[model samples]
Target: MALHNKIGKIGEDIAVKYLRQEGYYIIERNYRNKFGEIDIIAAKNNYTIFIEVKSRSSENYIELAQSLYYKQIAHLRRAAIFYFSEKNIHLSLIRFDLIALKIDPAARRIDKLKHFKNIID
Candidate 1:
């Protein structure tokens, strides 16, 4: 794999750890369908959260938060719908969350992670 891809995977691992510590029960990691991939699917406060994790080496030009484009959101929404129907789960609530990770070279770790929920209507 390329270096960037490797770094992204590392960031995702960190995000998963962070979510677990925050009391989220992880149902799936890297959930994929014909549409796209959801970085994490977790249950929290009686709702299922579909997370999109974007990691970056710098906050230049674009911050990690900018990665959640509209097309991606649409794909995620479709995937979420498929997930619920395929599993036959009558869910009352669902959320789309964006997790941003910025890597700090000086600290040799992720400098920060931001979780944004309800990203779509």
Candidate 2:
């Protein structure tokens, strides 16, 4: 994998580990549909979460946030709707989350990880 892809994969693994630690049970990773890929899907306390994961090896947090545009978020929402309908899953408490990670790929270390819960609202 290229450096960026490597960083992203590593960052995702780190995010999954952190989420498990936080009492969330993972249901999926890299769930895909026409809209795109939902990086992580998990459940916690009766809430099903759709997570968008952004990862970077560079030290530019602003860049990472800027990379995800409004259109992308809209696509995610649409994709979430498709996921619910396709999987035949229903729950009153559903959430959209954003996980941002800054990592050192060489060492496979997560320098920072931020979980922004309910990002859609």
Candidate 3:
């Protein structure tokens, strides 16, 4: 894989670890449908969460936070809906989340990770 894609996968891995630590049961990773791919799909406290993971080098921390645009957020919802439809699962408590990761270039380690819950309305 390319360096950027590899870094993104690592970011997703970090995101999964963080979510598990937060008591979320992972349902899937890199779940893709007609709309797009959801980086993580997890469940916690009766809610199903669709998450987008963004990763970047430490110097681009600001870009990481702002990377998720409005259209991307809409696509997340569309993907979630498609997932529910494909699985025949009724939507009860569903939400969107965003996980941003800033990695140290030299160490290839996470310098920062932030989880934003219910990021999309």
Among these predictions, the greatest lDDT belongs to 2
Q: Which candidate is the best by TM-score?
A: 2
Off by over 4 Å in 3: 60-63
lDDT of 3 by residue, 1-121 (tens): 7888878878888888889998999999999888999988999999999888999874566566678888987888899999999999996899888888897645768898877778877
Model 1 lDDT-worst window of ten:
58-67
Each candidate: what lDDT? 0.84, 0.88, 0.85
Candidate 1 lDDT over 22-53, as tens digits, reads 99999999998887888999999999999988
TM-score of each: 0.90, 0.93, 0.91
Give the poorly placed runs of model 2, Cα more than 4 Å off. Answer: none
**Mind giving the per-residue lDDT tens digits that candidate 2 earns over 16-120?**
999999999999999999988899999999899998889898776545655778999999999999999999978778999888888888899988777888978
How do all the candidates rank in terms of lDDT, highest first?
2, 3, 1
